[model samples]
Target: MKAKIHVSAAILATLCVISFFSITLLVELFGTLDQVAWIKSIIVFPGLFILIPAMAITGATGASLAKHRKGRLIQEKQKRMKIIAANGLLILIPSALVLHYWASLGQFNLAFYTVQVLELTAGFINASLMIMNANKGRKLAHK
Candidate 1:
Protein backbone atom coordinates (compact mmCIF):
# COMPACT_ATOMS: atom_id res chain seq x y z
CA MET A 1 0.00 0.00 0.00
CA LYS A 2 2.79 2.41 0.89
CA ALA A 3 4.73 1.63 -2.26
CA LYS A 4 1.63 2.00 -4.37
CA ILE A 5 0.82 5.34 -2.82
CA HIS A 6 4.33 6.61 -3.28
CA VAL A 7 4.63 5.45 -6.86
CA SER A 8 1.22 6.79 -7.83
CA ALA A 9 1.86 10.15 -6.28
CA ALA A 10 5.28 10.41 -7.87
CA ILE A 11 3.91 9.49 -11.28
CA LEU A 12 1.11 12.01 -11.01
CA ALA A 13 3.46 14.74 -9.91
CA THR A 14 5.85 13.95 -12.74
CA LEU A 15 3.04 14.07 -15.27
CA CYS A 16 1.90 17.44 -13.97
CA VAL A 17 5.44 18.80 -14.15
CA ILE A 18 5.85 17.55 -17.69
CA SER A 19 2.52 19.03 -18.71
CA PHE A 20 3.44 22.39 -17.26
CA PHE A 21 6.82 22.37 -19.02
CA SER A 22 5.27 21.37 -22.34
CA ILE A 23 2.59 24.01 -22.13
CA THR A 24 5.16 26.67 -21.37
CA LEU A 25 7.24 25.56 -24.32
CA LEU A 26 4.19 25.71 -26.55
CA VAL A 27 3.37 29.18 -25.26
CA GLU A 28 6.88 30.31 -26.11
CA LEU A 29 6.71 28.70 -29.53
CA PHE A 30 3.38 30.35 -30.22
CA GLY A 31 5.41 33.57 -29.98
CA THR A 32 3.01 35.87 -28.13
CA LEU A 33 0.47 35.97 -25.33
CA ASP A 34 -2.20 36.99 -27.76
CA GLN A 35 -1.48 33.98 -29.91
CA VAL A 36 -1.92 31.52 -27.07
CA ALA A 37 -4.22 33.12 -24.56
CA TRP A 38 -6.83 30.40 -24.94
CA ILE A 39 -4.31 27.64 -24.64
CA LYS A 40 -2.77 29.39 -21.66
CA SER A 41 -6.10 29.45 -19.91
CA ILE A 42 -6.57 25.79 -20.67
CA ILE A 43 -3.21 24.93 -19.27
CA VAL A 44 -3.42 27.20 -16.24
CA PHE A 45 -6.73 25.84 -15.01
CA PRO A 46 -5.89 22.16 -14.90
CA GLY A 47 -2.20 22.71 -14.41
CA LEU A 48 -2.73 24.56 -11.15
CA PHE A 49 -5.43 22.17 -10.08
CA ILE A 50 -3.44 19.02 -10.62
CA LEU A 51 0.06 20.32 -9.95
CA ILE A 52 -0.60 21.57 -6.44
CA PRO A 53 -2.49 18.53 -5.27
CA ALA A 54 -0.04 16.17 -6.92
CA MET A 55 2.89 17.96 -5.37
CA ALA A 56 1.31 17.65 -1.94
CA ILE A 57 0.68 13.97 -2.46
CA THR A 58 4.17 13.42 -3.76
CA GLY A 59 5.74 15.15 -0.80
CA ALA A 60 3.68 13.28 1.77
CA THR A 61 4.19 9.91 0.17
CA GLY A 62 7.87 10.52 -0.35
CA ALA A 63 8.32 11.35 3.30
CA SER A 64 6.50 8.22 4.29
CA LEU A 65 8.60 6.12 1.93
CA ALA A 66 11.83 7.64 3.12
CA LYS A 67 10.94 6.94 6.73
CA HIS A 68 10.77 3.26 5.83
CA ARG A 69 14.01 3.16 3.91
CA LYS A 70 17.45 3.61 5.43
CA GLY A 71 19.41 3.70 2.21
CA ARG A 72 21.77 6.10 0.42
CA LEU A 73 19.48 6.33 -2.62
CA ILE A 74 16.56 7.38 -0.46
CA GLN A 75 18.74 9.98 1.19
CA GLU A 76 19.72 11.33 -2.21
CA LYS A 77 16.09 11.47 -3.28
CA GLN A 78 15.19 13.40 -0.12
CA LYS A 79 18.02 15.85 -0.74
CA ARG A 80 16.93 16.35 -4.34
CA MET A 81 13.35 17.00 -3.23
CA LYS A 82 14.51 19.56 -0.70
CA ILE A 83 16.41 21.42 -3.39
CA ILE A 84 13.46 21.22 -5.74
CA ALA A 85 11.16 22.63 -3.06
CA ALA A 86 13.55 25.46 -2.32
CA ASN A 87 13.93 26.28 -6.00
CA GLY A 88 10.16 26.27 -6.44
CA LEU A 89 9.72 28.70 -3.59
CA LEU A 90 12.60 30.96 -4.56
CA ILE A 91 12.43 30.98 -8.33
CA LEU A 92 9.17 29.56 -9.63
CA ILE A 93 6.76 31.20 -7.21
CA PRO A 94 8.09 34.71 -7.65
CA SER A 95 8.34 34.33 -11.39
CA ALA A 96 4.77 33.14 -11.56
CA LEU A 97 3.65 36.10 -9.47
CA VAL A 98 5.47 38.56 -11.71
CA LEU A 99 4.08 36.90 -14.78
CA HIS A 100 0.59 37.05 -13.36
CA TYR A 101 0.88 40.67 -12.32
CA TRP A 102 2.18 41.76 -15.70
CA ALA A 103 -0.36 39.69 -17.58
CA SER A 104 -3.16 41.06 -15.43
CA LEU A 105 -2.09 44.56 -16.36
CA GLY A 106 -1.95 43.55 -20.01
CA GLN A 107 1.71 44.43 -19.95
CA PHE A 108 3.42 41.97 -22.25
CA ASN A 109 6.60 43.93 -22.33
CA LEU A 110 10.21 42.81 -22.03
CA ALA A 111 9.84 42.44 -18.28
CA PHE A 112 6.93 40.09 -18.66
CA TYR A 113 8.84 38.06 -21.18
CA THR A 114 11.82 37.95 -18.87
CA VAL A 115 9.68 36.65 -16.02
CA GLN A 116 8.11 34.09 -18.30
CA VAL A 117 11.50 32.86 -19.37
CA LEU A 118 12.64 32.62 -15.78
CA GLU A 119 9.52 30.75 -14.76
CA LEU A 120 9.92 28.31 -17.62
CA THR A 121 13.53 27.72 -16.73
CA ALA A 122 12.62 27.09 -13.11
CA GLY A 123 9.83 24.76 -14.12
CA PHE A 124 12.17 22.70 -16.26
CA ILE A 125 14.74 22.54 -13.51
CA ASN A 126 12.14 21.31 -11.05
CA ALA A 127 10.91 18.79 -13.56
CA SER A 128 14.41 17.47 -14.10
CA LEU A 129 14.96 17.15 -10.38
CA MET A 130 11.69 15.32 -9.98
CA ILE A 131 12.68 12.98 -12.77
CA MET A 132 15.91 12.16 -11.00
CA ASN A 133 14.07 11.60 -7.76
CA ALA A 134 11.59 9.34 -9.47
CA ASN A 135 14.39 7.30 -10.98
CA LYS A 136 15.92 6.86 -7.57
CA GLY A 137 12.58 5.83 -6.15
CA ARG A 138 12.23 3.22 -8.88
CA LYS A 139 15.66 1.83 -8.15
CA LEU A 140 14.87 1.68 -4.46
CA ALA A 141 11.61 -0.07 -5.19
CA HIS A 142 13.33 -2.78 -7.18
CA LYS A 143 15.89 -3.40 -4.49
Candidate 2:
Protein backbone atom coordinates (compact mmCIF):
# COMPACT_ATOMS: atom_id res chain seq x y z
CA MET A 1 0.00 0.00 0.00
CA LYS A 2 2.75 2.45 0.90
CA ALA A 3 4.65 1.52 -2.23
CA LYS A 4 1.63 1.99 -4.41
CA ILE A 5 0.99 5.35 -2.82
CA HIS A 6 4.57 6.47 -3.38
CA VAL A 7 4.55 5.56 -7.04
CA SER A 8 1.15 7.06 -7.61
CA ALA A 9 2.31 10.23 -5.91
CA ALA A 10 5.48 10.43 -7.97
CA ILE A 11 3.73 9.65 -11.22
CA LEU A 12 1.03 12.15 -10.45
CA ALA A 13 3.67 14.80 -9.80
CA THR A 14 5.63 14.02 -12.97
CA LEU A 15 2.52 13.88 -15.10
CA CYS A 16 1.35 17.17 -13.69
CA VAL A 17 4.57 18.70 -14.91
CA ILE A 18 4.28 17.12 -18.33
CA SER A 19 0.68 18.12 -18.62
CA PHE A 20 1.43 21.71 -17.71
CA PHE A 21 4.04 22.13 -20.41
CA SER A 22 2.05 20.31 -23.02
CA ILE A 23 -1.25 22.02 -22.33
CA THR A 24 0.42 25.40 -22.17
CA LEU A 25 2.25 24.79 -25.41
CA LEU A 26 -0.88 23.62 -27.09
CA VAL A 27 -3.04 26.41 -25.82
CA GLU A 28 -0.48 29.06 -26.67
CA LEU A 29 0.60 27.68 -30.03
CA PHE A 30 -2.12 25.30 -31.04
CA GLY A 31 -5.04 27.20 -29.45
CA THR A 32 -6.81 24.22 -27.94
CA LEU A 33 -7.36 22.12 -30.98
CA ASP A 34 -9.42 19.36 -29.45
CA GLN A 35 -7.72 16.62 -31.43
CA VAL A 36 -4.27 18.03 -30.77
CA ALA A 37 -4.90 18.20 -27.04
CA TRP A 38 -5.79 14.56 -27.17
CA ILE A 39 -2.55 13.93 -29.02
CA LYS A 40 -0.63 15.72 -26.29
CA SER A 41 -2.11 13.32 -23.77
CA ILE A 42 -0.86 10.49 -25.90
CA ILE A 43 2.61 12.04 -26.02
CA VAL A 44 2.71 11.87 -22.23
CA PHE A 45 2.03 8.14 -22.03
CA PRO A 46 5.51 6.95 -22.91
CA GLY A 47 7.07 8.85 -20.05
CA LEU A 48 4.26 7.91 -17.73
CA PHE A 49 4.54 4.23 -18.54
CA ILE A 50 8.27 4.24 -17.99
CA LEU A 51 8.07 6.20 -14.76
CA ILE A 52 5.08 4.56 -13.13
CA PRO A 53 6.53 1.10 -12.99
CA ALA A 54 9.89 2.27 -11.73
CA MET A 55 8.35 4.40 -9.03
CA ALA A 56 6.10 1.54 -8.00
CA ILE A 57 9.06 -0.74 -7.64
CA THR A 58 11.05 1.84 -5.74
CA GLY A 59 8.15 2.57 -3.46
CA ALA A 60 7.72 -1.12 -2.77
CA THR A 61 11.35 -1.30 -1.79
CA GLY A 62 10.90 1.65 0.50
CA ALA A 63 7.96 -0.01 2.15
CA SER A 64 9.95 -3.16 2.70
CA LEU A 65 12.80 -1.15 4.19
CA ALA A 66 10.37 0.71 6.39
CA LYS A 67 9.35 -2.57 7.93
CA HIS A 68 12.95 -3.13 8.83
CA ARG A 69 13.45 0.42 10.17
CA LYS A 70 11.72 -0.67 13.38
CA GLY A 71 12.32 1.86 16.19
CA ARG A 72 14.27 4.76 14.68
CA LEU A 73 12.11 4.77 11.56
CA ILE A 74 12.11 8.49 10.85
CA GLN A 75 15.75 8.38 9.91
CA GLU A 76 14.99 5.58 7.56
CA LYS A 77 12.11 7.54 6.08
CA GLN A 78 14.44 10.44 5.32
CA LYS A 79 16.92 8.07 3.82
CA ARG A 80 14.25 6.52 1.64
CA MET A 81 13.04 9.91 0.43
CA LYS A 82 16.52 10.85 -0.64
CA ILE A 83 16.96 7.55 -2.40
CA ILE A 84 13.66 7.88 -4.20
CA ALA A 85 14.38 11.43 -5.33
CA ALA A 86 17.85 10.55 -6.57
CA ASN A 87 16.54 7.56 -8.43
CA GLY A 88 13.69 9.50 -9.91
CA LEU A 89 16.04 12.23 -11.05
CA LEU A 90 18.28 9.61 -12.57
CA ILE A 91 15.35 8.32 -14.54
CA LEU A 92 14.45 11.81 -15.68
CA ILE A 93 17.92 13.12 -16.52
CA PRO A 94 18.55 11.39 -19.83
CA SER A 95 15.30 12.45 -21.40
CA ALA A 96 15.63 15.95 -20.03
CA LEU A 97 19.12 16.33 -21.38
CA VAL A 98 18.13 15.01 -24.77
CA LEU A 99 15.15 17.31 -24.83
CA HIS A 100 17.38 20.20 -23.87
CA TYR A 101 19.70 19.45 -26.75
CA TRP A 102 16.81 19.16 -29.15
CA ALA A 103 15.30 22.39 -27.94
CA SER A 104 18.60 24.15 -28.35
CA LEU A 105 18.84 22.83 -31.86
CA GLY A 106 15.36 24.04 -32.60
CA GLN A 107 15.89 27.61 -31.33
CA PHE A 108 12.55 27.76 -29.62
CA ASN A 109 11.34 31.08 -28.17
CA LEU A 110 10.06 32.59 -24.91
CA ALA A 111 6.94 30.48 -24.74
CA PHE A 112 9.09 27.42 -24.69
CA TYR A 113 11.05 28.85 -21.81
CA THR A 114 7.90 29.53 -19.89
CA VAL A 115 6.67 26.03 -20.59
CA GLN A 116 9.92 24.54 -19.37
CA VAL A 117 9.82 26.53 -16.18
CA LEU A 118 6.27 25.50 -15.56
CA GLU A 119 7.07 21.87 -16.16
CA LEU A 120 10.10 21.96 -13.87
CA THR A 121 8.21 23.61 -11.06
CA ALA A 122 5.43 21.14 -11.40
CA GLY A 123 7.86 18.25 -11.41
CA PHE A 124 9.55 19.46 -8.23
CA ILE A 125 6.24 19.88 -6.50
CA ASN A 126 5.28 16.39 -7.51
CA ALA A 127 8.50 14.83 -6.28
CA SER A 128 8.09 16.67 -3.02
CA LEU A 129 4.61 15.31 -2.66
CA MET A 130 5.78 11.80 -3.28
CA ILE A 131 8.29 12.15 -0.49
CA MET A 132 5.65 13.66 1.72
CA ASN A 133 3.33 10.79 1.01
CA ALA A 134 6.05 8.34 1.87
CA ASN A 135 6.60 10.14 5.15
CA LYS A 136 2.92 10.03 5.80
CA GLY A 137 3.02 6.31 5.30
CA ARG A 138 5.92 6.06 7.69
CA LYS A 139 3.98 7.95 10.31
CA LEU A 140 1.07 5.63 9.79
CA ALA A 141 3.28 2.62 10.13
CA HIS A 142 4.65 3.91 13.40
CA LYS A 143 1.15 4.15 14.78
Regions of candidate 2 where Cα sits further than 4 Å from its true position: 1-47, 54-105
C-alpha lDDT of candidate 2 relative to the true structure: 0.53
lDDT by residue (1-143, candidate 2, tens digit) is 65566556555645644564465456546563454334334444564566556556655665575665565555555565665466446534433444344354553456545545555554565556565655666575558
**What is the TM-score (0 to 1) of candidate 2?**
0.37
Which number leads on lDDT?
Answer: 1
TM-score of each: 0.86, 0.37
- Name the top TM-score candidate: 1
Candidate 1: where are CA atoms >4 Å away?
A: none
Task: Give a tens-digit lDDT track for model 1, residues 27-119.
Answer: 768657764454455455666676667777888878976785797898888898888888777886566556655665678888877877787
lDDT of 1 at 92: 67
Worst 10 residues of 2 by lDDT: 32-41
Worst 10 residues of 1 by lDDT: 35-44
Residue 20 C-alpha lDDT in model 2:
42
